[model samples]
Structures are given as C-alpha cells and as structure tokens.
Target: MNVYISADMEGISGVVHGAQTEPGAREYDRACALMLGEVNAAVEGALAAGAARVVVNDSHWNMRNLRIEELHPAAELISGSPKPFSMVQGLDASFDAALFVGYHAMSGTSPASIDHTYTDAIHHVWLNGREVGEIGINAAFAGFHGVPVALVTGDQMATAEARALLGEVATVQVKEAYSRSAARCLPVAEARRLVREGARAALAQRRGPLRFDAPYALKVEFVNTGQAEMAALMPGSERLDHRVVQYSHTSYVEVYRAWRVFYNLAGAA
Candidate 1:
C-alpha cells in the first residue's frame, strides 16, 4: 500500500510559541527534529505494516522545514509552498490512505497552541455552514481525491477536533494544550509509541479512501470587514455580511482552487 503524510509543525510536541515554529531559532531547530522524528515513526510503522511506499509532505510555514538529509531513507519528502494544492500537494486517489501529522485546532479554538485555520488573519472557515479547522479543509481536499485520513496526530485539542470531523479514523494526542502558546506534552518515547501504534491499527481496517461529497459551498469569514470586502470582489462571490463571503462550485477541487484565490485576494489589499 502507498501512504501520504501531510505534516504540519504547530502541533508538534513541545511547540508552544511562534519562535518554536519559525525557521530561525534554537527552539525551531529542536522542534524540527521532534517533528521529523514523529514523521519517521509513522513511516516506520507503515513500512512494518507492509506499506510499499510512503511520502511526507512538509506542510508547515514555507513548507521546507524538514531536514531532508535526516529523513528516513525509505521516505520521500515534499517541501516548499505556493504550489497548486499547498499542504495536500502531490496527493491523489492513488494512495491507499493519508495521515495528518502535527496538526492543530481551528482558528479561534481555545487553548490550542497557535490555533488558526489557514491563517490567523481569518476568523472562520465553513463548508456548507459547518465550521472547520485545517483538518476539515485538508480532509475535504483529500476526500475529493478518494483518500481516507486513516491516522491523525497532534495535541489533545487537534485530535479531538479531528475525531469530531473524522469519527472513524485513528487519532493520537502527543500533547495537551493549556493555551495558544502552551501545552502539557508527552515525553518523546511515549509520543512515538502512540503514533506508531495508531498508524499500524488504522491501516489494518482501511476499507477505502475517506470520501466527502461536495459541490462545495464555502464561506470564509475574516477577522475584519476590510478583508471581507476585498474577498467579495472575486467575481460571483457574495458578501454574506460584513465579515464573510460565500461561493459555490461544482466540485471540491474547484472550491479549493477558489479558496486559494479568495484568500490571496483578501490579503492582497
């Protein structure tokens, strides 16, 4: 079986501040090591379970955080940003399953370390009026391509949030959030075990890709009216209110493409 792992850094163990995720800093370096270690652990588990191939996408800021030289010899890394699919780039229906590693809660989630959907600049994001976090957005994208999110790992809040959206999947909590910049983390040894075990179990029951039906109607609410007004300028998009704009498309792929355009336009001005 082939598997894809979309790895983000915010929810990695011991990560609690901007300094920890940013590219330059002692904490950032250490955090990258932690993130890579967990990713390797997941890959190891998948290999042990008979997976023929595994790919790791560095979905964090700038998307180039993982150290390629240190990556598991058997795994390939997808790095960089501004690609057509962003976090979920290179993913398609070919893979047997997908995994979200080091993910966190949605924007405005209380006690989730550095919580935010796609960006802190936005306040909320919705698909058919239901609020969602990164997991929801990325899951929707994966589901569109016929990939089930078999395993997810992050902090307590992130795991809980994923469960709410993806009930049947396996989730592992590497840490417990105390606030946006603080958390009660599991020790390195224990965190690795949970992730590996979860991955192994999740693959055993893989029925099929986690699919989400859509003609996806998306509503993105910004933190300020100015951003909303800017987003509304996208042709055919409607201003739902002072802070939100709505759009509809025939497929999740189309909606995702529009989401990228909408957010870029909103932030441009």
Candidate 2:
C-alpha cells in the first residue's frame, strides 16, 4: 500500500508555545527535531506495515520545517510553499491512505495547544453547515481524491477532534493541554512509540475515505469584518455578513482551492 503523511508543528510533542513553531524562534529548532522524530516514526511504522511508498508533506507554516537529510531515507518529502493544495499538497487519488501528524484543534478550541485553523484570521469554517478545522478540511480534500485518513497524532484535543469527525479513526495523543499554549507533554520516546503504533494499526484497519455529498457549500468566518471584506474580493465568493464569506462548487477540490484563496486574501487584513 502507498501512504501519505502531512506533518504540522503546533501539536508536536513538547510544543506548547508560539515561539516553538516560528521559524527563527529560539525553541523552533528543538520543535523541528521533535516533529522530525514523530514523522520518522510514522514513516517507519508505515514501512513495517508493508507500505511500498510513503510520502511526507511539510504541512506546517512556511511548509519547509522538515529537513530532507534528517528524514527517513525510505520516504520522499514534499517541502516548500505556494503548493496549490497547501497542507494537503502532493496528495491525490493514487495513495491508499493519509496520516495527519502533529495537528492541533480548530480555532477557539480551548485547552488545545496553539489552536488555530489554517490561520489566526479565520474564526471558523463550515462545509455544508458543519463546522470544521484543518483536520476536517484536509480530510475532505483527501476524500475528494479517494484517500482515507487513517491516522492522526497530536495533543488530547486534536485527537478528540479527529475522532469526532472521523468516527473510530486511529489517533495518538502526545500531550494534554491546560490552555492554548500550556500542555503536559509526553516523553519524546513514548510519544514516538505511540505514533508509530497508531500508524501501524490504522493502516492495518484501513477505513474508507470521508466523502461529502456535492454540490459543496464552503463558508469561512473571519475574526473581523475587514478580513471578510478582503476574502469577499474573490470573484466567486459572497460576503454573507460582516465577517463571513461563502463559496460553492460542484467539486470538493474546487472548494478546497477556493478556501486557500479566501484565507490568502484574508491575510492582507
């Protein structure tokens, strides 16, 4: 089987502060190391489960956090930004399953380490009226291409979010959060072991991909009216209110693309 892994940083083991996820912050280097270890653990687990190919995508901010030299040799890495698909870039119908590593809860999720969905400007996102975060959005993208999301690793809230959206989906919690930037982290060794085992078990179970019925109704609510105004500039989107923009399409992929555009536009606010 072929496997795809999207690695984020906020929910990485031992990460509980914004400084740890920023590129040049003092703790960023160590956070990257922790991210690498968990990613490699997932890759190794996938390999042990008889996967013929495993591709890892740097899904965090800037999309260049993982170093090629430090990655598992058996897996190929997708790094850099301006990727059309962003977090779920390089993903398609060709892969058997997808794994989300080091993901946090959606924006406004209390006690979720570094909680935010895609960007801080986005207050909430809804697909067909159901509120969702990065996990739901990306999972929908994978589902659009017929790939199931099998394993997700992160803090307690992150794991709970995944299970709530993808019933019975496998998850590994590396920390328990007391606030957005405060968590009781697991030992690095133990966290890696849990991630590895979670990947193996999830792939072995092989659940079906999440499929949303078309046409898709995508709505994004920004933190402020200014952000929504900027997002409303997208040719095909509608400003539903002072802080929400709505877009629709018959295809989930198009909706996903529009989502990227919406947020990028909102970033200007």
Candidate 3:
C-alpha cells in the first residue's frame, strides 16, 4: 500500500505559541525539530506496516518547514508554497491512505492549541451546512480522490476534531491544551512513539474515506467585512452578509480550490 502524510506545525509536540511556528522566531528551530521527529516516526511506522511508498507534504504556513535532508530516506517529500491542492497537494487517487500530523482545531475553538482554519482571516468554514476545520476540509479532499484519512496526530482538541469528523480513525494526542497558546505537552520521545503506533494501527485498519455528496455548497465566514468583500470578488462566490461568502459546485475539488482562492483574497484585505 501507498501512504500520504500531510504535516502541519501548530500542534507539533513542543509548539505552544505562534512564535514557534513562525520562520524567524527563536523557538522555530526547536519546533521544526519536534515536528520532524513525529513525521519520521509516522514514516517509519507506515513502512513497517508494508507500505511500498510514502509521500510527505509540508502542509503549514510557507509550506517549507520540513527539511528534506532531515527526513527519513525512504519517503519522498513535497515542500513549497502555492501548490495546486495546498495542504493535500501531491495527493491523488493513486494513494491507499492519508495521514494528518500535527493538526489543530478550528478557529474560535477554545483550549485548542493555536487554533485557526487555513488562515487567520477565515473565522469559520462550512461544507454543505456542517462547520469544519482543516482536518475536515483536507480529509474531504482526500475522499474526493478515493483515499481514506487513517491517522491524525496532534493535541487533544485536534484528535477529538478528527474523530468527530472522520469516525473511528486512529489518533495520537501529543498534548492537552489549556488555551489557544498553552498546552501540557508530552515528551518528544513519547509523542513520537504514540504517533508511530497510531500510524501503524491506522494503516492496518484501512478505514473508508469520508466523502460528501455532490452539489457541494461552501460557506466561509471571514473575520471582517473587508475580508468578506475580497473573497466575494471570486467568480461564483456570493456575499451572504457582511462577513460571509458562499460558493457552490457539483465537484468538491472545485469547491476546495475556490476555498483557497477565498482565503488568499481575504488575506489581501
């Protein structure tokens, strides 16, 4: 079996503050090291479970957090920005299963470490009528390509969000959040062990993908009217109110792409 992994930074084992996730901050290096450790653990686990190929995507801000040299040699890395599929970039129908590592909860989720969906400008996102965060959006994208999200690793809130959205999937909680920027973290070694075990179990189960119905409706509520106005400029997007923009398509992939456009435009505001 082939496996795909999308790695984010916020819910990384040692990450508790925004500074740690930013490129120039003093703590960023340590954060990246911790992130790499968990990713390597997942890769090792997937390979042990008889996966022939493993693809790792750097699915965080700037999309260049993981160093190829530091990664496990058996896995290929996808790193950069403006990827066509963003977080789930390089993913397609060819893979057997996908994993989300170091994910966080949705925006406005209390006690979720560094919670935010896609971007700070996006306050909330809804597919059809159900609210979702990064886990839901990316998992649905994987489902669109006929791949199940088997494993997710992060803080308590992130794992809970994943289970709630994609039932019974394997999860590893590396920390327990006390606030958006505070958590009771697990030691790096312990967290990596849990992640490795989670990956192995997840691939073994081979859960079904989480798919949504066609004629998908996407609604994005921005943090302000200016962001909403900018998002509404996209073709096929309608202004639902002062802070919400709505877009719909029969294909979920199209809606996903439009979501990227919406946030990029909103960020300009």
- lDDT leaderboard ranking: 2, 3, 1
| TM-score for each model | 0.95, 0.99, 0.99
For residues 155-202, could you state the per-residue lDDT of candidate 3 as single tens digits?
Answer: 999899999999999999999999988999998899999999889988
Tens digits of per-residue lDDT for model 1 on 18-124? 78888888788898998988888898888877899999999998898898899889999998888898889999988889989899999989888889887756899
Query: Residue-wise lDDT of candidate 2 within 1-269, one digit each (tens)?
Result: 99999999998889999888999989988999999999999998899888999999999989989999999999999999989999999999899999999999999999899999999999999999989999999999999999999999999999999999999899999999999889999999999999998899899997899989999999999999999999999988988999999999999989998999999999998
Candidate 1 lDDT: 0.86
Residue 21 displacement (Å), model 3:
0.2
Clashing pairs in 1: 148-210
Q: In model 3, where do residues sit more than 4 Å from their true spots? A: none
lDDT of 3 at 63: 90
How many steric overlaps does candidate 3 have? 0
lDDT of 3 at 58: 96
State each model's C-alpha RMSD to the native. Answer: 1.4, 0.6, 0.6
Give the distance in Å from residue 196's predicted Cα in candidate 2 to where it truly belongs: 0.7
